[model samples]
Target: MKVIAINGSPRKDWNTATMLRHALQGSADRGAFTELIHLYELDYRGCSSCFACKTLGSPSYGRCAQQDDLAPVLRRIEEAGALILGSPIYFGQVTGEMRSFLERLLFPYLRYSREKRSLFPRKMDTAWIYTMNCPEAAIKDAGYDRVFAENERLLKMIFGGSCFTLTSHETLQFADYGKVDADMFDPAGRKARHEQVFPRDCERAYELGARLAQNISRGLPS
Candidate 1:
């Protein structure tokens, strides 16, 4: 079975991408064919709200109508057994790229009828990773939890799939703290914490990957 991990970070090798790679490695170790996609590399827009996907007799019914870089990616997702998406928090929300990607990814499944069903595959297992500058203890205060939680809800309610989440908190923002005026954060302290905790976070991501693969293979909740 194939598993696809999409990185929503513009920096391909930064924290978000690194965590996704670890998760993919875990899936790979469990014998699932894995591929990684960097969303920023593609030229695409969010759903155009064309309504063609919802129109009767439309050839592209229940699918995104925009023919762009994301169309093929959507096809890949439709065929995959599992999916993992990672993005860094931008101003308490997902980056514009990630938000656009999600709009296209999930909007096609929405319908106006009473049936409340979507076109998404019935059995795909999914996970979301959010990296943030806010400390873990301060997430609620920052109110970023609502954004990611709503995203998780979309995966579960629309897709009827098991959803997992990971957050890397207080992420380092620069190679040298002195170069930027990050006065609110203790750069040295944040760096030290990241050094101590990131490895463990990666381990958790690996576990998530392995567990997702196993559960998806068995057609069970992860």
Candidate 2:
């Protein structure tokens, strides 16, 4: 099985990327080939809304036509047994890069017909990992749960596979809070959580990846 992880954060060694790396490591330990792609390194635009993907009889039908760095990544996803997306919550939503990536990745396979909702070629496991600076209690109040649910729903609809999510809250955002002008956060608390809780979250991410790989190996739906 092949598991691919996409990091949507600009900071490669930060919370979001760390969670994805742990997940990929778990997948690898389960005898699955794993790859991680960082979106910030790529130059690409979101879906152009040209409708070439939706146009009947067109050569690009059911596929994104944009020729860019993300296009090849989309093609590779077609052959992956599982996909894991990691992003830091920014302004109550995923990072802009992640949003754009989703636009290109999911739009093409979306069927407009009433009978069929997706044109994806096969079923595969999909997951989302979100790292946020906010506390866990604030998620529902901030309506972030709704965002997570909607994304999960869309992935399940388009991929025809099981979808799950992992969220790491109260992530440490800076090495030294005193260096930045962010007085709203409690540096001591953040550091405490980083030392006490982040490892638990990383362990959960690893378990998630292992479960996906084990399911794929056993011919079970993820």
Candidate 3:
């Protein structure tokens, strides 16, 4: 089985990327062929609402007709057993780049998931991995629930799969987080807290990955 991970972080080795990589690494250990795509390095735009993809004779069904770097990526997503989408929190939600990418990425998947009705026996599973400079309290902020909830619903509707979210809040300092980064979601700048929280986050993520992979192997989804 194969899994594709999309890294929506602008930085190379930062929290979002690290979490995705580790999740894929755990999947690899379980013999899942894995691939990682860093969207920042690609030249692509959100999506053209052009109805070209919906044309009767168009070769691509729900995917955009404007071909760039993301077209091929869509095919990979279709064949993969699972996907881990990692993004850094921006303001109070996923980054624009990641959000746009998700829009484009899900377009074709949405067509397949909704139109192809034989998905009763098995389906793909996807997880969201994220890191932020804010704390859990920040996620609980008054204004953020709607945004998070909307994204969660969109994920489930688009992927025809279950969703698992792993998040680490308050990740501003790389060094501080690295201390416990091997296993947890400790924020970067909070040195003392980093040592305590990072490992747990990592462990949780690793376990999530394992469970998701096993689900695919057993024709189940988490």
Candidate 4:
């Protein structure tokens, strides 16, 4: 089984990256081949809304027509058994990198794999990772939940599979120079969230990967 993680945070090795690293680590421990693609290192653009992909008899499935960094990433996503996307909340929404990458991902699914195949590919699963300064108890109070929920809704409509969200509170405070405290920080801030939220939100990603590996091995589940 192959698990692909797209870390969309510009701060590639920070809060969001750290969490996804653990999540992907879990996938690795489960015997799944895993990779983390940091968006900051890639060169790509958001969907340009070109209809060229929808032209009749297109040969490219799961590929964006735009010749940029996204094409290679899309190929990896299609080949992977599981997907875990991580983003840092910026101004109550995902970062520009994440948003743009999301557009690239959605455009294909929205267009029905460029008329070549279905978006979900029969048994693939996706998970979303969010790390922000907002505390868990105050997620709704911060009003970011609405924005994220809307994004999730759109994702579900487009992908049609189990999607999970993992959010971290006081993420900014978690680090000094990109290194979180070893211990003895304010427990009230994000302790409950950290302890309670192990990999529950990302378990589906692994399960989905395993299920997908099984399905692909069984020839697309009939």
Best by TM-score: 2
| Model 2 alpha-carbon drift over 4 Å, by segment | none
Task: TM-score each candidate.
Answer: 0.96, 0.98, 0.83, 0.75
Q: All candidates: CA RMSD in angstroms?
A: 1.2, 0.7, 5.2, 5.3
Question: What residue pairs clash in candidate 2, if any at all?
Answer: none
TM-score of 2: 0.98
Which regions of candidate 3 are displaced past 4 Å? 109-122, 174-189
Of the pair 1 and 2, which is ahead by lDDT?
A: 2
Model 3 RMSD, rounded to 1 decimal: 5.2
Candidate 4: segments with Cα more than 4 A from true spot: 112-120, 173-222
Q: How many residue pairs in model 4 have overlapping backbones?
A: 0
Candidate 1 residue pairs that clash: none
Candidate 3 per-residue C-alpha lDDT over 1-222 given as tens digits, one digit per residue, 9 for 90 to 100: 987889888887877777777788778877788898999988889877776655667776555676888878876787889888888878777888898887677654454334663222246788888787767886666466576667767777766688877888766556644555455553434665556676677777777777777888887755
Better of 2 and 4 by lDDT: 2
- The Cα error of candidate 3 at residue 205, in Å, is 1.3
Residues 111-192 of candidate 1 have per-residue lDDT tens digits of 7767866667576779998888888899888887788788888888666778889999888778789989879889888789
- lDDT of model 1 at position 220: 80
TM-score of 3: 0.83
Order the candidates by TM-score, highest first. Answer: 2, 1, 3, 4
In the range 54-147, model 4's lDDT, one tens digit per residue, is 5566764445688887788887787776677888888888889889998888766665535534454654556777877666788888898888
